[model samples]
Target: MNTIEVKNLNFYYGNFQALKDIGIAFQEKIITALIGPSGCGKSTLLRCLNRMNDLIEGVKISGEVDFKDKNIYSKNIDVVELRRHVGMVFQRPNPFPLSVFDNVVYGLKVHGVTQAFRLEEIVERSLKATGLWDEMKDKLNSIATELPLEQQQRLCMARLVAIEPEVILMDEPCSALDPIATAKIEELMFELKKKYTIVIVTHNMQQAARVSDCCGFMLLGELIEFGTTSKIFTSPDNQKTQDYITGRFG
Candidate 1:
């Protein structure tokens, strides 16, 4: 059931250690929420799964992050292929300045898929999967930025789905949206877990409680506790986790 595993992981942004000896295994096709205060390596650890930290200058990572039995950090590993298996969605809705149709199909195009009918099928399915198809079905060729911000975020999800990744990583995905938009996205997150193993970082404790089956709490670059959401919120083994969940301290 462990689809992704990390062991003895350590990461540094030029000697400033961001994560320290972090290890956890994610169950397949379930929602796992990573929660903690800001700058606790929640997002940094999320990025490490798929090697996004490689983009930062002077960054060095030392870890064994295995996805489907392969060490993602191995020298023979292909980052592009690794990313294709593990897709990430950012905090903001960053749809490119192109038609909605193009935005979703862009990934397919990059991988040398150019058949018009097949591309259209993927675009429709991706949009539908994110619940954007009914709304944007009639305006496929219109500029993507013209849509409401909520729809735009869903479009970003559609863009991620177009590639058919096995895992989806969301970093504070609903932080920028209003409560209503956030609720919709939360619902979408619930729906998405049936198909993909989702790892989400959230500032909203309630959101994490509602959506995630399992939860991990991190602090000061260390994993404090990880368990079922019910146990983590109600009766955590770690004092830090209890304090955090109760709002006594963060």
Candidate 2:
């Protein structure tokens, strides 16, 4: 089942077009990776899914972005609730400057979850889901920024999980981590796909191949190709995809 679908989507920042007639569907409970060079609109397209671009000044969009079969850009749609359902993780760790416990429960608190016992339960469960429970259990009061970068990233994920988001959007989530930490994040993505739909914008071709079931290759402001990761890597139907994947050009 497709959880989200984009049709003839176009986005503009002021007078400059950032995306052009893009269309794609993200399968339910699977990982989809968008790969392209910097400034190719990969991240812009990712932000479109959750309407994150709305926060930018003078940003305009034309087209349909259907989430769970409803147009997200509709006048009656609640942007705040839309964002609650589609969580986003940025290129950097970006943990809140609060304690570990507060960071994990931040989302819950925002959404009006105030019971002490319930908050504790959510913190433990979210941390465990991201494989950070043991590491953070004894230091719940420590400042989130004081943790290692990798741990900070995991805490960000945990915060998202506490809110029970349906889709998780990651933009170069591992760009700041070491190889070992990157591997761990990749492993976590696999586990995450069993329950939540994931869409990632990544520059690392290998990471896309290893972690995503479906891959989309973007160039300039358009999607050049999208297909199963195996076919996209081994036998792409588009020359642009082949060139980008084979190191001919990006």
Candidate 3:
């Protein structure tokens, strides 16, 4: 079933339109990769899903974003809860200055989960799910930022899972990691899709090929083509998609 559906979506930052009549649906518990050149509205659209763009000045969104059959942009929708349901992992690892355990449990606390036992359970489960528990379990009270960038990124993922979100949005998550680290994260994404639908914005074609079930090509604020990853890379219907996949200018 489709977990997220966008219809005729439009976005603008100041006078410049960043997304134009974009529409797509993300199936539940699957990986959808957004591929495009820089400034192609991939990240902008991703941010819109969780209303992260609302934080930027002069940002405006129009049309519908249906998440699990509910319009997330409706006036009555709780923005905080919407974000909690659709968690995000940024390109950079952004662990808080506090202890690793505290960072993982931050979202639950923010949403009024006050029980220490429950918080510990969530942190343990989340860290174990993200494959960070064995390494960090003993060091839960240590500053998380002190970890390497790759571990920090996994920690960020663990933090997102701690909130028990329905969808996980990643914006160029491997952009800052080394090749080995990137491979590990890609493998982790395959494992994660069993529980959470994933939307990832990636500049690396190989990474998308490796991790995505579906791929969408965007250009200059427009979604030009979307289909199964094999079809997109093997025999794209759109000329632009073909060019981009063939190492021509994106």
Best by TM-score: 2
Where's the lowest-lDDT run of ten residues in candidate 1? Answer: 54-63
lDDT for residue 22 in candidate 3, whole number 0-100: 97
**Candidate 1 lDDT, 178-248, residue by residue in tens:** 99999999999988998999999998999999999999999999999999999999999998899999998
Of candidate 2, the 10-residue stretch with the lowest lDDT total is 241-250
TM-score of candidate 2 against the unseen true structure: 0.99
**What lDDT does candidate 1 reach at residue 3?**
90
lDDT tens digits, residue span 69-129, model 3: 9999999999988898999999999999889999999999998998989999999999999
* lDDT score, candidate 1, position 214: 97
lDDT of 3: 0.94
Q: TM-score of every model?
A: 0.98, 0.99, 0.98
Indicate the residue-level lDDT of 147 in model 2. 96
Each candidate: RMSD to true structure? 0.8, 0.6, 0.9
Give the C-alpha lDDT of model 2: 0.95
lDDT of 2 at 209: 95
